[model samples]
Target: MEDSGMRIGEVAERTGLSVRTLRHYDEVGVVSPSGYTPGGFRLYSGDDIERIMLIRRMKPLEFTLEEMRGFLDAVDHPDTPGARKTIALIRAEAATRLEKLRRRVGYAEEFLRLVEDL
Candidate 1:
């Protein structure tokens, strides 16, 4: 194992994702580890961890795996006009979803208050 890279287990712990989930991400080619140990263990660098964190954020916003790949590609090439357009579209979609989520949470809170009143 390289001293500069963290093992998959460490990445999972830090990212709050299961080893299985990380493996799935790797298998899907959404996020590949930066290095591998002599024993064939996966090792992730700081940039890999940052990318995983971005994936974690997107999951809650209901971004699909394919969408993730596209978004990451755009992130990697932010200087391109096409990438800029992709980012704009995704950001708009995310905003809409977050607004819907907030409304649902408001409803849930109201229900909880009514139940407490009883």
Candidate 2:
């Protein structure tokens, strides 16, 4: 809607996120408007877009909404400590998902074999 400050649609287009998802992020306190438009529309800034992009990519990494909030919080609040805590959180969940996927893939493979026999 506005080039000076990208509106929600432009942000969605640029970030490959749906407007609905952006609103959900707002409600979830994941990301919010830097300010409003002359017509009272939400206007996002470059910083907001960057954060949303990071969140977008992190989703498939299996980071929960709350964990994402934490990551954002950590980003906001820098730390000199080792990455053990962050690694533990992401890795444990990813491993869990990996195991679940292995089971699902195994089932699909068996199903394919049965289909071939039929």
Candidate 3:
């Protein structure tokens, strides 16, 4: 309930991610909360919320948790030489995923047409 941070439930409501998903992300080292309450409740800062939003954007493109973590690390340390390469790799992967999604949408449209004809 601090002014600078919010509890997990509030973050979940704001981010449209479930509390369980947030906990799992923490457990897996994807996007951990900034701090914890005296009672051990996770408290997330605005930076943490923004990090979670970035991860959410990657999820729909089918990025694995590890991949998401790598992208976040690259974003945080952009001055590192390897960070540029990592980001390029992520962009390539996203492009590939976009192509696959387009193909799937085409198949779904064909399926809808078949259903309409039946």
Query: Which stretches of model 3 miss by more than 4 angstroms?
Result: 1-3
Alpha-carbon error at 76 in model 2, in Å?
1.0
Whichever of 1 and 3 has more TM-score, that candidate is 1
Residue 35, model 3: Cα distance from true site in angstroms: 1.4
lDDT of each: 0.93, 0.82, 0.93
Error of 2 at 49 (Å): 0.6
| Ordered list by TM-score, greatest first | 1, 3, 2
Off by over 4 Å in 2: 1-3, 80-84, 91-118
Q: Tell me the TM-score of model 1.
A: 0.91
Model 1 off-target regions past 4 Å?
1-3
Compose the digit string of candidate 2's lDDT tens values, residues 1-109. Answer: 4536888898999999899999999999998988887778898888888899989977766678988887677677656363457656666877887788778889999
Write the residue-wise lDDT of candidate 1 on 17-92 in tens digits: 9999999999999999988888889989989999999999999889999999999999999997799989999999
TM-score of each model, paired residue for residue = 0.91, 0.68, 0.88
TM-score of 3: 0.88
